[model samples]
Target chain A: MTRLLGWILRYGIAALFVVAAVFPLAWMAVAGFKAKTEVVATPFQFFPEVWRWDNYTQLLADESFLRSLGVTFAGAVLFAALSLTVNALGAYAFARLDFAFKRILWVVVITTMFIPGIAIMLTSFVVVTQLGMLDTLAVLVIPGAASGMQVFFLRQYYLGVPVALEEAAQLDGAGPWRIFTRIFVPLSKGAFVVVGATSFLAFWNAYVWPVLTITDPELFQVQQYLATFRSDRASEMGLLMAGSTLAALPVIVLFLIFQRQIIAGVRITGLK
Target chain B: MAVTTLRAPARDTRSRGRPAGRGRRRETKAALIMLAPLLILLGIFVIWPLLHAVYISFYTWSFYEAPVFVGLENYLTVLTDQEFVDSVVRGLAFTAMVVPAQVAVAFLFANLVKSVSRKTAAVLKVTIYIPAVISEVIAAIVFSLIYAYRGGILNWFLGLLGREDTAWLGETSTALPAVAVPAIWIGMGVASLIMLAGLLDIPEAYYECASLDGAGPWTKMFKITLPLMKNIILFLLVTGFAASLQFLVLPLIMTQGGPVDSTTLPNLFIFRHFTNDLYIGYSIAAALLLFAVLGAVSALIFRLVRSEKAVDG
Candidate 1:
């Protein structure tokens, strides 16, 4: 009887978790196809009585949605590429090269993780404005182009690479830059992809920074655009759900493809 | 521990170098070249803004007029402000609710998954972790539909239970909790994975020995699992607390700290003052205070974790 009770408890809790994790997202996707009348009807409908494609069609045809989508795509790609290159180089230096004040410099970099962006945002806003980056796409990518976490994470991975490979390259008269690009970068490809995907997801999902920095509607990223679109069309639940689905699709797809690397990345960086 | 082990051998090799000075200079030049982009960006954006935040906290400037020196006046005003105090309390309350709930739920799920087969565990982990990859903004929007009043899913469930539909996010009493639901749900995936990693790290022999000694499941869990998982628990708590304290995006989009400011986190409070009221200095002061609190809490967790490790050793 006790063993039976334990089996029930185990599966029961697992069932609850699966439901909680999947239901809201599944409902949102279902609701996007829901008709306007069905969405507001009392005694809520789980699946739409009549699946409507108008929400998706209308959102696709909308100028602002298209523009914001373009901006989001470009911004995420650019931010990921720029940050990966810069952070990988910095991480390589920390992991391999000898330098003055290396320990203190690394400490300084890690300390920035403790300084929450909210604390420095006001001044960051002022600095960006002074640099004439406000209301521009550069505001979305440039300020966050170098993350302390990315550097620390990549450095940890780079440190695990065998020094004999680099030593052999040095004996063959290869320079530091050549050794890093040929040996370190290629070996740490998995870490690079992890960092790149994370950076991309971060930029894609960004809300507050974009909202605070960009005033122009055309310049808005998908998330900022979605929030404002929701507020503007608050009464239209169908269209709003559609917008949320569209905004969430890219990251969802990315996560599905790269789930293993992402999970490994979290374990490595998060634990240490 | 891994960091020290990895760093030791690298240092040993460098210490026995032949052409030490010339090699060091070349390495330094290469390092500087590689690090230039990171340093320049950090200098302009991160480091400068951090210093400027401290500097601006002591002055009253609204961008239209020249800065006027206030010298602790902004700090005093922010400290005594009732709204600021309430925001901090609400933030702490949110953190209190989120951290424990997430840790417990995550722990439960991790333990449950461990009892299953390896193939089943892998599939379960992926499904549960999917929500965490979705952005906070998207998660909040998704939950808004779930919590919607008229045709909302929650109300629909309430109808089945013969209970009256409540405005989950529209009332003061329920607003904070409602906002917290999505935060906890989205957080469960990552937290569970961390906990699962910790659980899997334990040797199978420990459980087998416990079973031979006639320990029940509960005893094995509490006496063996929990004690061994303390470090992972500490990691989850610290990161969870810090993340909760900086909660902004969900609240910003969902309620705008609405229904009489009931869900106003300190970050949101600062956001409103800086953007809407244009009280830049005041907002910076409040933000600084929030940072100090987070720092202290983090330090406490670090010390606790370190001491626990020492005792284990």
Candidate 2:
């Protein structure tokens, strides 16, 4: 009886934690299909009386919403690509190269890793403004492209790549660039994919940075755009819920498709 | 070893007519090419901004106003401002709540998952990690609904248990903790994953030996698990603390530092001063102070970790 009780307690707690993690998101998705009035109705409408597609369909048709989504989508893609290239190249050099000031340069990168992004928020915006990159896609994608953590992770990965392969390629007269592209890039696809996928999710979900920087309605990120309607918490509440759902759907889908990499990405990017 | 041997001897024989300096120069050039883009971007975006933030913290600049160099006046203002002081204290309290809770939750979730069957653990891990992946705005939105007075999930569940409705975000006292709940929810998973990695990394043999010695689960954990995973636990605490220091999104979205500014944590204060109020110098000074505190704490932890390692090294 005691052992059975223990088993029950263990799994029960586990189940509770999982439910707590997922319950809010699941409700948001469900409430997206409910009428705005029905969302906050008496007896707590757990399910919609009539499923509504108007919220999503209307957002798809709305020019402002579409523009925001387009910026976010394109920004995420460009960020992932740019971040992957910059960090991967730096990592490759750090791992494999014999170069001048390598130690000093690497120390700089690692030290900057400890300086939290929030700490530098004001100055970064000032720098971007001075550079005339404000309200443009360049501000979103370019400034965040280079990452110390990514470079570090990829460098660690490259260190594990066999020197023998590179030596053989060297023997075959392949240049350093060719060897990197043909050999290291192909071999480190897992690491690169992990970085790229996380970068995409990060840019997609980014709320604070865009909120601070972007004022142009045309260039508003998806999350910032949705935040505007949140104060409109009138009868359009369900529609707002639907907007939140749509904003989060891609990441959820991405997580499901590449969960293994994404989970590894969490460890890769979350903590040192 | 084999590759180095073959390549090393073959290289000298193959390039006997050429000096090693030529190859060294080529490798250096290649490395420079590879590193240029990253270095340039980091210089502009990361390094220079940090320097400039410190530089601007000394000036008096606001929205539509020219920046005037005011020496150390901004720093003085940040130090004396009562609102800023209250926010920092609230932020510390929030950190105090979040850091320990995150470490505990991560420990609890990690150990539970570690004890389960592999398949079940995998499934549970994925679902439980959902909050970490979702955006802060969406999470905050869902949570706001959950805390809604009329039709909130929390109040509904409480009402089922015959409890009274509480204005969680609307009440001055409850607003901070209410805001902190989602912070823990969002941050705890990755900390758990780190802890899980640390847990899995322990040699199964150590636990087996402890079990053979009639060790209880708690005993085994304290004796075998905790001691081995000290570094990882320390890491999670410091990292989680740093993360919670930047607690802005939820408070910004959910409360707007409402109920008489009770939910205004440090980051929210800095953000408001920077963007909303556009007190650039004061905000930058406050941010730099925050940066200094973070740096000092991190440095202190490294010192602690290093000293601990000396005894155990």
Candidate 3:
């Protein structure tokens, strides 16, 4: 009975996850094949009587959806690159450099972790607007390019890298740049991968700043567009679901590929 | 190891500026050089914006009017406003309701995951974490479909049992909790992952002894697990509180913070004021207040967690 109970509990939790995780996607998928009447009909059917391929066709025909996808993709990729570069160097400094006020500076940076991003977003908007970057992808990625959590996590991982490797490169009379490029960069690939994964996921999924900064529908990232689309009930539910499914596709792929690194990074960052 | 140490081999080396210190200076310079771009980025992105935000919070301004310094008046108005008060009350209530539910469910799920084989654990982990990866807006859309008034998948499933269709999102009573359903759904996976990490940190020796002493799984869990996982629990409590306090997107998308502002959170209120120009000063004031509350809560959590860690140690 005890063994049976344990088995039941294990399957129970697994079922919970499976249901919770896949149901939304499943609903989206099922609903994509559903018509408007079938979508709102009483005694909801999981499967539609008629598979409407027109939903996909209609969504594909929408220029706004395509543009939003392009904008989101570009912003996410650029932000990921910019954040990764900044985090890599900053983390290297904290881990290896003998700088004045190192501990104080580190504390300052890490404390920013506790300050919620939304609090600073208003100021970010003002600055971005002043700089004439509003309604552009630069505004989307530039203000949030550096994150304290990313820097701190990278620093932790960088500490695990052998310090002697850098010393050896220096012995060859390598310039600081050369030493960093040759010795540290290659060795810290794991940290880079982890940081890059988190950065990408964050940038891709960002909604608030994108909504605030970009007033032009042409500049709307996938999340913002999908949100606005969902808000309008007149828009076909199937097409909206299809777009949402498409928006999630890249991150889902990224997660599958780098699940270990991403999970480890999340766990480490969340510890603080 | 000795060979690798040549790059900057000084463990106890004090200053690298003098005759022997040249190498230290070089390494330090390199470190600064590497870190320069990041500092510039952080200064532009994080620090400057934060200072600007605080500055703007003190002023009465919208996009239309030039910002006028209102000092503490904006704050006073925000604090005394009935709507603001109601929003804060509702936000706290939601946090109070949701945090315990998410944490408990997550712990249960994590323990279940640990019992399975590595392969099954991986599959479960992927499934659970999928929601965590999806954007909040997308998750809201997904749930909106599930909680649709008449034709939602959930209501359809319920219809098999001869239950009447329920308007999950349309009703004031069900709206906030209904929105929270997705928030908790996505949150459960992240929470479970955190708890699993804590579970792994537990030493095997404690579990072995409990089993040898004839403790069943329940006894072992209570006696050995929860005590060992206290720090982990506290960590979740603090961060979860901080994150949930900013709950805006789910409610914004699902109910627009309504069925009569029943679901309007503090952050959504801030969003509303900031966007509309009418409440710019008031919004800033609300945001600052939210920030102050969050700061106080986090500090309290920090002190509590530290004390607990010390006691456990």
Q: List TM-score (chain A only) for every prediction.
A: 0.96, 0.93, 0.91
Which number leads on TM-score?
1
Clashes of each: 0, 0, 4
Identify the superior model by TM-score, candidate 1 or candidate 3.
Answer: 1
Arrange candidates, best DockQ first: 1, 3, 2
What does candidate 3's lDDT look like per residue over A8-83, in tens digits?
8878778877987787787777677777666656666678898878877787788888888888888778888999
The parts of candidate 2 lying over 4 Å away from their true place are A268-272, B1-19, B62-68, B276-279, B299-313
- Which DockQ-derived CAPRI band holds candidate 1? medium
For model 1 the local lDDT of residue B150 reads 79
Model 3 lDDT per residue over B144-207, tens place: 8777766676788778888887888888888878877787877877788878877987888998
Native contacts retained per candidate?
0.56, 0.51, 0.56
Local lDDT at A57 for model 2: 85
In model 2, the clashing pairs are none
Off by over 4 Å in 1: A1-8, B1-19, B299-313
Better of 2 and 3 by DockQ: 3
RMSD of each: 2.7, 4.8, 4.4
